[model samples]
Target: MQLINYQMQRFWQYGGFNPDLYLFIPLSQTRYVTRGYNQVSQTWSPVLKKHSNVSEALFRVRATKAQSTLSRAQRKRNLKDAFSLSHCIQGKNIAIIDDVITTGSTMDAAAQTCLDAGAAKVWAFATSLTPLLGK
Candidate 1:
């Protein structure tokens, strides 16, 4: 928690805070049930509670296999049309938060879903970035 707080503070210092909304990547019902919580949400909840702009505005409408085993192209295909917006984010700037980013296909799908729901712009933040093989 201390590390997350430090990172959040650094993000604020760098002017990466203050998005209109903070949207955590939604886990599928199956995954959520299996895991009992979304780790990203769990980690960000305290800071987000202070800001009061945290929202579960997006949800997964379909399930996909664990991304760790997938190739980049397969990851993109797996996430296609997997998310749905629960409310209008019209003209709002959104920041999608996640624990880690690998190929970024998941974030791309989430951003596209937000755009489809009328978000003005979307930015993504992750605690870690996993380098792709041979990169």
Candidate 2:
């Protein structure tokens, strides 16, 4: 928790991004039920609570196979049409947060959904990135 808060502070200080809205990738209902919590929200949201723009508007529409168990191509397919926006954000700049980025398919899908909903721009921030799976 300390590490995530520190990283978020650094980004706010130096990342030069001031988004109109900040959205975190959400876990599906099934996963949240099994885990009893959404780790990403728990880790990232507290640091962002002072910012009024942080929102829970983006949501997973259905459960999919875990990305850790999939190949890059499969990862992309797994997240297709998996996300939706709950509000209209036309001409707004959005920032998406996640715990870790692996294949980037999850972020891509979420960003695409935001764009399709009329967000003028979208940025992705992750605490960590694993090497490309097939690299």
* TM of each candidate vs. truth: 0.90, 0.90
Cα RMSD of all models vs. native, in order, equals 1.9, 1.8
Which pairs clash (backbone N, Cα, C closer than 3 Å) in model 1? none
Counting clashing residue pairs in each candidate, in order, gives 0, 0
lDDT of each: 0.89, 0.90
The positional error of residue 124 in candidate 2, measured at the CA in angstroms, is 0.4
Clashing pairs in 2: none
- Measured on C-alpha atoms, candidate 1 has an lDDT of 0.89
The CA root-mean-square deviation of candidate 2, after full C-alpha superposition on the true structure, stands at 1.8
Tens digits of per-residue lDDT, candidate 2, 12-123, equal 8898868999999999999989999988888877788899988989999999999988889999999999999888999999999998999899999999999999999999
Worst 10 residues of 1 by lDDT: 10-19
Off by over 4 Å in 1: 13-16
Model 2, total clashes: 0
Q: What is the lDDT of residue 86 in candidate 1?
A: 88
* Displacement of the residue 60 alpha carbon in candidate 1, Å: 0.3
